[model samples]
Target chain A: MTVQLDFLKNVLYFSGLDLAEIESIDKLVFEKSAERGEMVLLEGESATDLYFVASGAVKVFKTSAEGKEQILSIVRPGESFNDVSIFDGGPNPASARAMGPVLLYGIKKNDIEAILRNHPRVVLNVINVLASRVRHLVSLVEDLSFKHVIGRVAKILFEQVGGGQMGRGPRLTQQEMAAMAGTAREVVGRSLKALEEEGAIKVDRNRIVITDKEALKRVMEVSS
Target chain B: MAEMPGIDREKCDGCGLCVIVCHCGALTMVDKSINIIETVECDWCTDCEAVCATGAISCPFEISIE
Candidate 1:
């Protein structure tokens, strides 16, 4: 199958590559699709290629002793999965499942290494991505320790409200918000009630409408 | 859907095992005791509870702020 070099060029890692280099890199990359509920990777399996989401979403999670799966991260389009394990020479640390119909680009580590050697810009881009991940992890650690559960839940809703079009929506279900916050579903339910009573936000089904962004930010400002 | 295991500051002996066993890097050694960091990645797996020997960990069924 022909690789979509032009499309690949738009991804940050490939933006600096020339057409010929893009074609060469694309030759080593393959496209794959997964339906919702399909496992993308098995935990403890050898890590081989990194999967970049081109469309749809995936959930990274691991099974607990009680056989309950704990979601570790959500991978959206323009992001890649299995990065940390690949860098550590370790097996896949977690399993991934397609949150919905997903399309991904699979690139082997060797190919990525070769590209990095030739085009150092790609390495910088990857480093930026990994650094951002580390920062996010660090922030989460801080939130768990210092912030009150209510503040954490409110902050979660506020953060999910991005700029324009996407921000104004119905309130999300307590379960989904709790899933994203890594807390109990009821914790979210209670927090939403508190916020609603305080006129912080309005909850409607699974959508959370940010009625007062400033007030919500104040609610999240409490230290643990 | 459980409260994340809580760390008893007085009981924890500053051992970092919880930090070591946590797959999502949710547990951190803060001031010599184990503390859970709220990352979107945390799944409340209770690994810290399983690893803690002092019985300092507990996952409450609820966290009501009101």
Candidate 2:
């Protein structure tokens, strides 16, 4: 019980709450575990609860009629999702899938609403986070629309490296890269090949190594 | 044909930013106006809509999937 309260207090949305408030929230939340590739929430489903990642990761994405997927964002531990649906009283805007074995704390909408009503400051925090999300979505739109495949791939690489720097990032598959870039897998493959030819990035069996970050940035800057 | 995004010509300043942002090459600029050249490739991600500073482009027929 104390452990759960501690976890609740660490969540950004609940961080403003005092220990007593955190304890109260802990009572209203329940833990849910999902294996990798499990669908935690489906797009268009009624938003009944808000979820906070307790452990592992979740991928929020949209799929087309032809099964093409565009990843919106990846929610890491301590992050929350479905807040928009909960507040707007609308269905989920996107689907959430477990990227790995995941643990989440599900807070019923009614319970959360009650807490928010009592603590208006928490609402401010929520707004701040939502605003950042808007910025990210706008940047993603810019990347997809204005940037070429190689540029998009380079941008993703730089982002994964925590900005344009030579570093090892997560081991992402070609399909994952395609989804992040909002393009097809073949396009991502071709772009990576081009980058490799330019001596900008080194591709291994599972991961990519940034050989020259400046070159990658130059690739992104060259207008198509 | 896939549902394509609508551009409000009246509001559009013909900045051509939307043309540059479309990854699928669905948008083109003809006579300083944005046009949807290929609707099939358009995933309707609304990248053009998001970047439209004048709020000119919108996806009227596009469902709110995300």
Error of 1 at B10 (Å): 52
| Interface RMSD of the candidates, in order | 14.7, 19.0
Model 1, C-alpha of A18: deviation from truth (Å): 2.5
List fnat, each candidate.
Answer: 0.00, 0.00
Regions of model 1 farther than 4 Å from truth: A1-3, A145-224, B1-66
Top lDDT hit? 2
lDDT of 1 by residue, A109-134 (tens): 88778888988888888888889888
lDDT score for residue A216 of model 1: 75
Q: What lDDT is obtained when candidate 2 is compared to the true structure?
A: 0.74
**lDDT of candidate 1 at residue A193, scale 0 to 100:** 69
Q: Per candidate, chain B TM-score?
A: 0.73, 0.83
Q: Model 1: how far is B14 from its true place, Å?
A: 51
TM-scores, all candidates, are 0.53, 0.55
